[model samples]
Target: MKNDSYPTSTIANNTKRILVLFAHPVPQQSEVNIFLFEDAQLLPNVTAVDVYAEYPDFNINVIKEQERLVNHDVIIFQYPLYWYSTPSILKEYQDLVLEYGFAYGKGGTALKDKLFFCAISAGGKEEAYQTDGFNHFTIRQLLQPLEQMASITNMTYLAPFALFGSRSASREDRISTHREKWTTLLNALATEHIDLDRAKNIENLADLTINGANE
Candidate 1:
C-alpha cells in the first residue's frame, strides 16, 4: 500500500512533493531502512511507497507509477545496497514503469526537471568503498547507471545519502543517529533548503551539513 494519504494542500509553500520508492527484499531483517521509511511517513509532502509490498508478484502498475512520478518533484530510491545495486524488484519496477515513450527516447519527458537520488544502507564500511579499498569504487561510482538514468530522463541527479557500516549499526547503536539524519535530509529536500549545486558536487549528501556549516 502506498502512503499517498498526505494532502498537498497541507504542505507549506515553497516545499516540494517528494516520492520515496522503498525497495527492500526482506524488511523484517532490516535494521535501518524500515525505521527510515516510518520517519518519512510522519513527514508532510512525502509520499513513501513500499515497492515490494505493492508488487509482491513483480507485476508493476506502470500507469500508477508514472502518475506518482509526475506528481512529485523529487524521486528517492530508499533501500539497502544489495550486491552493489538495488534490489531485484526495484530494477524490475524501473524497467517496466520507465518505458520508452514515457521516461526516455523521443517524446519522453514525463520526468523532466525532477530531482533523483538514492538513500542507501550498505554493509561495508565507508573506507572500504574508496578507490584502493575492498570495493575499489565509491558509492557514487557504483551507482553510475542510476545517475545516467536520471540524466536521460531529464531528472537532476544528486549525490546519494548513504549509511556505511550498516551491518553492525544496530549492535553499535548507530541506527538511531542514522535514522535522524535521514529524516533531516528528507526535510531539507522537501523544503528546498538543500543546495542542489553543492549536492551535485558531493559524493555523499550525508557529509554535507543541513545548515550553513558545510557549504
Candidate 2:
C-alpha cells in the first residue's frame, strides 16, 4: 500500500490524541465494527484508518504507519475478535508496521509515552467468556499478547472497547444502543475521558461503562 499523506497537527497542550486502526476483511458483512469505525472517525483528535481498505494485499507501508504513530498520543486497534484474536490482516499489519527500531527495541521512542487500546466485537455472548462459561478464558487473558506488546514498547495499555453478542444483535439493536456505544467510545478517546488504569484493571471490556457527555 502506498503512503497516504495526511495533514499533521500539533497535539493540544492538554489534550490527548488518538489513532484508531480499523481492520475488517468483509465490511459489507460486518454487524458492529462498521458502525464503530464510522462513529470513531467523527472524533476531532482521532485518526481512524481502515487497514483492509488501504492494504488489501497485505503489503503494508511501514514508514507511513510509523509516521502516523509518531504524530498521535494514543493508538487504538479496532477489529472483530476472530479465533480469539485479531483478524489475519491486522496481525500482518502489526508485524510490518510496528517494526524493530520504530515501535520497539532501542531508540524506538515513537510510541513512547503514548497510550494503546483495543476496540473489538465478539460473536460470543458476555457470559460465554467467563471462567465457568463456554469460552473458559476471559477477554483480558486472551489479549495478553497485546498487553505484552504495549509493555515491551513502553506504551500504556488501556482496556478494550468490546461489543459482545454480535452474532445475535439485530439491526434495530445496532442502530440504537450499539451505535451509541461506538459514539461514546470515540468521544471518550478524543476528550481524554478514558481511564486507562481503571480500564486495565477490568476483566472484560464489555463490563466497563463509558461516561460520555450524555451521561
Highest-scoring model, TM-score: 1
Candidate 1: worst 10 consecutive residues by lDDT? Answer: 1-10
lDDT of predicted model 1: 0.87
TM-score of decoy 2? 0.88
Cα RMSDs, all models: 4.9, 3.9
Compute the lDDT of residue 28 as modeled in candidate 1.
Answer: 93
Per-prediction tally of clashes: 0, 0
In candidate 2, list every pair of residues with a backbone clash: none
Please, what are the lDDT tens digits per residue for candidate 1 over residues 139-181?
A: 9999999999999999999999999999898899998888777
Model 2, 95-149: lDDT tens digits are: 8877776667765556777878788888898899888999998888888899999
Q: Which stretches of candidate 1 lie over 4 Å from their true place?
A: 1-13, 212-215
When summed lDDT is taken over every stretch of 10 residues in candidate 2, the lowest stretch is: 1-10
